[model samples]
Target: MKLLLIPDKFDGSLTSESFANAFVAGMKKSGVPFTSRYIKATDGGEGFLKVVGKYKPCISIEVISENPLRKPIRSYYLYNKEDNSAYIELAHASGLELLQYDELNPMLTTTYGTGIKINDAVEKGVKHIYIGLGTSATNDGGIGIANALGYIFLNDKGEVLPPIGSSLRLIKSIDDSHVSEKVKQVKFYTVHNVINPLFGKDGAAYVYAKYKGANDKVISDLNKGLIRLNKVVSDKYNVHYNDVPGAGAAGGAAFGLKSFLNAEFLGTIDFILKLSGLREILHKESFDYIITGEGKIDKQYLNSSLLQSVIGLGMEYGIPVIAICELLEISKEDLKEIGVFDVFDLKDEQKNLEYNMKDTAHLITAKTAEYFSDK
Candidate 1:
């Protein structure tokens, strides 16, 4: 049998590469003869650079950046010399993982730290920048990044807003007079797999702010803020981005990138799949099963572009799809509807998360052997 492995990282446990390796080992141990294609992938949120570097020539450029609270931290981005392009993972500076649970409030958080990273690259003369936005902790729109690059947000009193979510509803106007010429010239791309709009029922604030630590009242206020910011942008620029498919991503950071930097958008899964030559492979080869997964299997996985993309490919090529994850939480009916023929999870019910994560490779190997032993 020929297997196509393009699994996602198992959070703290395995990268897609390592996941593929363990699965293959299981196949070998099961005495199943197989040929395989292993491609390392990311959603372009966390492990973006590592996947990009596998196919592109890039170097890590380290700099001092700020956390979502405006505190300083060390971070880095990938820079490709060939086209003077830079790939920045926004979570590196503004992700939820950077904050403690008590510090998770989005109202006080800012994307200013991510802006600092962008500004640093701009200062270094990079012409194109790709910002990966996901797992964010801020709901300030893009004002934080704009502030770092010389745009100022002001309240009705003409006092500069602090570039936080709490200030969103208070925004009376914007000051772009001091925005640098270089910042204006560079091309920007918001990279992720989000399709939500900027600010309404399904917009950034209402859908994502709560997860970023906002209560009902706070989510309401944050939504109002985003509304204000959109109105201000429309009045000033005679433009609208509030309804754009990806404008609501990263707590409206995608909105900011577009309204401020004139950014375009890219889907991480599509980008990685195309760049990895997987589509090209479809021209000459076929697979018995295309394997893919993330940390957990649930309803979100069913709606996800990652799993959907794999399923689409499997459907197009008449191949079945299988998945391996750290845990399985989706129903068999859901799997059947998605065209997944089989699923495997390596979770050790009696073991703690730490132990399971540490022993993931062994677990995956054993599980894989079990799944294919009869076949």
Candidate 2:
């Protein structure tokens, strides 16, 4: 039998690399003799670069930048030379993980680090840039990034606006004169993990800002800033991205890229699955069963994420797919609706949240191996 040990990170518990190893170890201990394949599947989240490492060596670049809450931090971007492409995972620099619960303020955070990374990629002469827009800690509507790329935001008094939400309304003119020549030649792709527009009740600020520590007033400010910034971008560039699907991603970075750089926006899972050649792998191997999962499985699993892609590919071969998650939130009917034959949770029956994660992983691996070997 052949199995694919493909799983996203367990969030707070394990990284993708660690989960892959533990899963394979469990299969071996269960005495399931099978060829196993490992693939990193990041749906524009923090573990994105770790998964991409399976395919390429990442080029590291350093730049002085600020985190989501405007605190200084050093960040890195991964460059894929073979494809002449660069990947910017915002979480790697200015993500929610960079701040504490109390520090999560959308009103003050910015995408400045994200912009600096893009500038570094351009300087490296990359022709294509793919930005993974998930786990952001800001609501600046991509103004911080555009500023780094030479799109100056100014007030009526002709003074440059500070890189924050409160100052977004001060914009009167945009200057693109200093934007590097390479920027015009490169193609930009925004990989959005969610489908939210830039400005509306369901827009970035209203829906997601709360998680970033926004109160009612802050959310109002964020929305206003996004509205103003979108207009500025559209009026100057002759494009409107405010109502575009996925425009609200990464705290309006999605809208910013679409309007300013003419980037192609795609579902993060779909793009990663295609790039990883997942379908080809499934076609090459005909297995009786496929086991797939993430650190946790919830209603969101119905979306086109790593586990969903695995199930879809398995169905093509008439194979049953069993999802093994660190935690499972769906009912049996819901699991069926999502295309999983069965769902397994790795948590101990008697333990609470503080259960030893390593032991739990081994237990899950053993159970998975036994399930296949029994067949």
Candidate 3:
């Protein structure tokens, strides 16, 4: 059988690259006489550039920037000189991964580093820029980025306010007189992994701030701040992005960019697949099965364009699609109705979280061996 293996990062246990390697190693050890092709999948998260850079020609540009906590760090972006286009991952500068557990306070973190990266790219004369927004450590509503790009936030007393989540409530006016000239010439595109809006019950603060270490009071404050910022943005720009789909992505980075930078948003999987030419590959090659998975199989995965696209491709080609995850939260019948042929979970009766985390590669290999052995 010919199988296509395309999996996202398994969260804390394995990256996409490591998971593919382990799965392939297990197949080899099992002596399974099958052909396989591997491709890494990313929904604009940590491994975005690694996967996109695999298929696109890009020049790496490194710059000194700040982390979520405003600490100086070296970050990079990929630029294609031929098209004068650049790709920037928000996580590179202000990702939650850049901070320690104790430092992960959303109200204190900022996206200033990401803004600095954007400023660097714009100054390089790139005509078009694509930003990947995911796995961030801030909920500043993009004010931090605006601050980096010379958009000043002022209090009612006309004093500058720090570009942090807590300062959103104190902003009296946004000053754009010092905004970068380079920003006007470029077209910006934002790729989003989720479809949540910028404000309300399903908004940025309510939906994501807790994960960034927000307490009940902080969550309430952040939500109010988001509401205030949304109104201010609409009053100034005459455009309301608060209710737009995907506006809540990356802690309102999408909403901020859309409101201030004229950014267009695209679905993460659709854009990446097009960039990687996955459709062309599927049309040209014949495979019996497609295997894809992430760290967990939950309701959220059901809404992911990545999984949906994989299932669509499998159905179109009359091939079966299987998912192998560390944990399975959905019922088999539900998964089957969505076009997944089967799910192989690492956490069966004989395994637990600790065992799976400790020996992920071995477990995956053993499971692959058993599955094909039965077949």
Candidate 4:
């Protein structure tokens, strides 16, 4: 029997590569006779570059910046010299993980560090910049990023506002005269997840503000700021950004990029899938079972569309696909309807998830080996 195991990272527990390694070790120890292959799939979130790292030559560029709490943080960017292309993952700077529980205030956090990365890349003379926008701690609509690029947001008093989302409402004028000339020549692609608009109930504040420790009043203030910022940018660009797809990504950072930087948005998963040659791999291999897993399996997994794509590919080849997840909260019928042959939970027979990962992995591999060995 042949097996393919492709999984995303288990969030904070294990990287995709590490998870693959663990699964392989368990398989070998259990005397599995089947051939197995593992792939680290990226939905254009954190490992987007590494999945396609071979296609793009990466050069490290040091970027001096600050995290969400204004703390010093030294970051690096990936530059592809061939196309003069550079990519920066937002998690590297000013990400949600960079902040402490007490430091997750949407009104105070800023994407200034992310801006620094972009500026550093632009100064290197890159023509195309791809910014992966996810896991941000700030709710600002990219004002802080523009501030780093020399755009000033001023208040009615004619004083520049501090870099924050809640302050975007007070901007009486936006000054772009101080921006570098090179910025105009550059094009930007914002890699994102959601396709929601920039404002209203479905917008950044109401959708993601609570995750960053925003309260009811803070959410209201943030939505107001986003509305005003959206108007200012729409007027400047003469393009409506209120209902644009992906504008709500990264706490409305996509909206800010659209209005301020003239950037286009692409779903991270679809982008990464094409770049990683996943289609070619799927066509080239024939497996008895295709095993895929994530940290959790819920309604969102069915909605991701990337998973659906993978499942569709598996079905086209008549390969059985099973899911092995940390948590399985969906109904069995739903799993079948989505083309999942079976769903297994790693947390179900164990009390401590972290402590039991190794043993659980061993058990899963052994079970797989026994199943194939009998066949």
TM-score of each: 0.91, 0.85, 0.91, 0.85
Residues 228-273 of candidate 4 have per-residue lDDT tens digits of: 8877776766778878866877778888787778897866545655
Give the 10-residue window scoring lowest on summed lDDT in candidate 1: 300-309
Question: What does the lDDT come to for candidate 1?
Answer: 0.86
Tens-digit lDDT track of model 2 for 1-375 = 776665667767776667667778777776767777776677786866666666676776566766766667877777877888888888877689899898887777788778888888888899999888788888888887877788877888888886766667667778888888888898999876566789779788888888888999888888887888877777888888788877988888888887768789876546756778876776677666666667677664453256766666667668878787777787867888767887777778787776746566675666777665665
Residue pairs clashing, model 3: none
lDDT of 3 by residue, 301-347 (tens): 55433676677768888989988888888898998998999988887
Task: Return whichever of 3 and 4 wins on TM-score.
Answer: 3
TM-score of 3: 0.91
Instruction: List ranges where model 2 is wrong by over 4 Å.
Output: 28-33, 155-159, 167-178, 235-238, 273-275, 300-305, 308-320, 356-359, 366-375
Compare the candidates by lDDT and give the number of the best one. Answer: 1
Q: Tell me the lDDT of model 2 at 134.
A: 82
lDDT for 57 in candidate 1 is 87
